[model samples]
Target chain A: MPLIKGDQITEDPWVYADDEDELPSGDVVVHLERWEKDKDSLRSRNGKLGLILRSDQSPELVADDLAAFDLIALDFPAFKDGRAFSYARMLRERFAFEGEIRAVGDVHRDQLFFMHRCGFDAFEVENAAVLQDWLEAAREFTSVYQPALDAKQSVLRLRHHTKKAAE
Target chain B: MYRYDEFDRTIVDERVKQFRGQVARRVSGDLTEEQFRPLRLMNGLYLQLHAYMLRVAVPYGTLSSKQMRMLAHIARKYDKGYGHFTTRQNIQYNWPKLEEVPDLLADLATVEMHAIQTSGNCIRNVTSDQYAGVAAGEIEDPRVYCEIIRQWSTFHPEFSFLPRKFKIAVTASEDDRAAIRVHDIGIQLVKNAAGETGFRFFVGGGLGRTPVVGPEINSFVKKKDLLSYLEAILRVYNQLGRRDNLYKARIKILVRSVGTGEFAEMVDKEWQFIKDGKYDLPQDEIDRIKAYFAPPAYETLPATDATLKDKIEANADFAAWVKRNVAEHKVPGYGIVNISLKPIGGIPGDATAEQMEVVADLAEKYSFDEVRVTHEQNLVLPDVKKSDLFVVWEALSASDMGTSNLGTITDMISCPGLDYCNLANARSIPVAQRISERFADLSRQHDIGDLKVKISGCINACGHHHVGNIGILGVDKKGQEFYQITLGGSATEDASIGKILGPAFSYDEIVDAVEKVVDVYLEHRAPGEAFLGLVDRVGLDPFKEKLYAAH
Candidate 1:
């Protein structure tokens, strides 16, 4: 299967020590928006568990009824449509569910960093130029912000509070 | 009045470049009106009835003297020598060329201001009580939280494309001058069982075709969870809100349909994920943003000045103006001064270039270089010393900004209805002028005591007519300008939508219709009962009986 995620494109993707922790399929069959209508019915299907439903389909609803799935795809639909971004943020900050969140469909190359900050672990680009753009966009803006997921604690807040950093 | 750091400056500069490119693309043949519409709207540019209008965000309606001067400069250079202050703590330039907007945005950025998110379906300018930092009644200035929300919502990655435009108003006092009851998210600062500072949130309140006084969603939302809860509400709206019909797109429709309790449950379920995230009230960030709005170095002075008393007694007009327009300040020597943008029968909230210059000069001379624009369509000198009241009065009178009507029936909040707005069904300015002229007598208005007259041209309720004590909605009946009059509506602590009084009235007959109701109130009111109180006591039947009884 064609994949945009996992370091298999660049490095060893599956770090699992044993084979039982990994799937037997050589290629993962990804989920699409049409399957979102019958996601509950498809969760029990044989080969369908390889991919996850997109974030645009109410991330909260998906979290509440998270039928055991390995990967979830967060689709941007367009660069301006932001519900998917908020969806990723909720998944990381609120749900506390540790899993691979993949960015897919309509996801632009420039928004990869923000997608990562919101908690997407992997990305699906439209083209090869977009792949390079995604890597560059992810590294350009360096300063941390307040609304970001806790990749780093708020140093500004800590500095202002006690007037000294804790040892 | 937050200062712009390098980060703020960079973001705004980049945004200006983006908007300029978008404008070029639209003008050239690269983009169509349908495609370019949202992009232009995000930048606060609108294609109105006559021209392109640019709305500049005056965050929480506060401006420094330098910023006020920049606005005056923009008004003279780009617009028709005037600016219109809006209810949501922003200013609108009615006559701006589409090509010259980028330059205007660049100028505004110099004053630490920009038009970002002023018009789009994003979180609009977070509004608060105009008397936030200096009011006698406010507890721990509402501008503090307003600033916090501003920083958090600025280029917020998640909530940019909401279902409909969102407005959030905060008020510390139980007496809400911010009209918090009529916003999408109305947050009142309240004390919990432990007497700690927190928020009481009300959701789904708004003023449009469907007027809803927001229902209480949270009794005590901790201060730290403000951003998380707001995210949850927006998430709920973005996900479940109606995209099929434009009229039903507002969150109020969703709340009314699904019920506020269910909506709150949905938000709570979403909030469970983010409340513990990194977006909390880290004391440092709050202090950093709060330092910008902290009170200025004020000199200790007497509360009442003998010199001012002499000036007031010498000129009866000046005394009436001082008593009516100025409000008590939290500090002993200072006061909040209100300069009327409405002069007699002139358009409400319209300040010409000369008037803006005078206001800027007064700000520089009287209370330092700080200024504020009140939601009441008036300019506010928020830190004026009580001793300088007479001088302000003189300067305002000379520039025709010294109309001594604040909160009276004559100080109506009116939009540029059919005169300029493409959406208005009927003309509103003419009706406001007629009503102002009718009640030109100061003594009559003083007797009327604290009545709000809000007029909207169409059902979109841009003028906020639904909450006015005397609400006038203009409509076209067979192409004739007829106004539907409503009574007992208000935007205060006791807020309610006005009740329609029978059939509509002709343009000429509307003034008579209002006068007849006032006459009825004057006849039936007990001692000290205002128009609203009288309506509550005698009911709409009395007013309805008089409107069509003998006519």
Candidate 2:
């Protein structure tokens, strides 16, 4: 899977660990259930811990242990499922998670812009061929109307700033 | 009437470019239809039964004469030389090709217009009272807040892919002209006891398979906290709204499931964090948008013009039209004229490019170069002089646009049913036409008086049948089209969902059935009583007995 960070498609550093698999030594992204069940063991391990939340799972459940995870990956499940977008924002804004948040599963070039706005710093898209497309899509719009976790200068702010400057 | 500043221009231009690329990818097979559906929908493009239908947003239903001409141009150049104005105060072109949509969007961008969020799960166009600024008894123009919501909701990253589509409507008038009660989120501007302007929030009111009247969640949210409150409500809905069932995905269902009190509590909890945060809109920004909707320059003329009275006395036709189609404006010497799109026995709300040009020309000449599209699927010249009534009527009458039946039975709100919509169960236009033809007599229509007969092709209530005084819902009964009737519903200060009247009627019997209901109302009505008022005093039993007597 290609992981896009900002304008670059850097290699994914975190290894995704599935159920029934032995824990990896380096930074590993585990399923939410697995992390919940073995949080102590996972934290005790020398490897960095990360949690991958399903679309239905609330980030509030894991907000207390948000600092334990080096990265958080949100599963889209489907392109139309937007729960991940809200989850990503909650982890960043409410949980005050400072680690990397990656979008996984059904991540497409079209959703890159919105996903980026919701505080996803990295993307784990299934297709590597559209890396350039993803990069372009991330920076497609010059202005945003809403204030998001990305803290991009909203159009209202820009206009207010311009008027104040003129004054 | 708001012109795009440089930042607005850049945003709209970028959206066009983005949509252009998305369309290219879809054409080149890079993106599948499933992937492209939302992208296209966000741009207000839909693949219907025949061709692509592009819904162009007339922001808060306000339009300049120039924008109206551009719509006419698009109708003539791209698709068929006609367009249908919707009940949401937007216009829809039925026959545009997918290949030409990008160009169409680009053209719209030129006039500070784009089809963004007209469809899709995102927040749709923020509709408002058509007579916002000009309407009598308005506290303030609702379009200022509507434009604020429009900006905040447009391309909202966290909300663009919600469980289902969202609709928001704002109204400043005490008389609910915008039908705020049946929207996903309805904001009514109110003055507090302290004379401070505040917002009253109504969450989760919608009409579809399940019709719900949104309850007032917060009676008073300070003007500054409006956006924050909205964000909180949306965040709660986004996380918890039912996504498993397509039919139950709207916020109305969630609000109903958890009860309005619980939902309000949840939203209030979420709002605590957002109320004074960065989401609180600045007073200067509100002032900025408010300036765009300021009352237009008007000549200082007498409240009543002698020439208009003389013309009315001289010409009976002009007098009748003035009584029906013209409304009292807030400004002196000015009258708001509703140009009837529901010409007798014509497709309701359908206007040809030539007619649009005529209206545009009329707006520029008679009105102050401003026009409004009413949710009743009609056009309004909001600043017409009382003196120009005769000339305006004459010009409109020449183009077969003057029907002199505003708020009459013939002035029906009918959705583009099976004729254009893929989701339609039966035809709505034909049924509306039959009803219109049945009540064709002008005197009879006027005598009947102020009756709203809304027809919907399906239960989606796009025609807003649920709130009409007399509601008609088209149903498919084992592949055969059947029309169901409902009575006593209203979209007003006293808003109520219409009650279902017995069994469904065949398409042929529906018109007569409607006539019988009207005749019953006429017979039972007391002196100076309206149809709805009669229904209110004397219940649906009278009309139902008359309607289903033979059956």
Q: How far is candidate 1 from the true structure (C-alpha RMSD, Å)?
A: 4.9
Model 2, B112-137: lDDT tens per residue? 89898999888999999989899889
Each model's chain A TM-score: 0.66, 0.94
**lDDT per residue, candidate 2, A32-151, as tens digits?**
889877888888898788888888998888877888989988988888889888888888887788889989888878888899889999988777776777788888887888888775
User: Candidate 1 residues B117-213, lDDT tens each?
Assistant: 8988788998888788788766677888987887667656566667678889999987888888899889999888798888999988888889989
Residue B151, candidate 1: C-alpha displacement in angstroms: 0.7
Q: All candidates' lDDT scores?
A: 0.78, 0.90
Model 2 chain B weakest lDDT span, ten residues long: B542-551
Per prediction, fnat is: 0.33, 0.84
Q: After superposition, how far is residue B386 of candidate 2 from its true place, in Å?
A: 0.5
| TM values, all candidates | 0.88, 0.98
lDDT, residue A66, candidate 2: 85
Q: Where is model 1 chain B poorest over a 10-residue stretch in terms of lDDT?
A: B277-286
Best-matching candidate per DockQ: 2
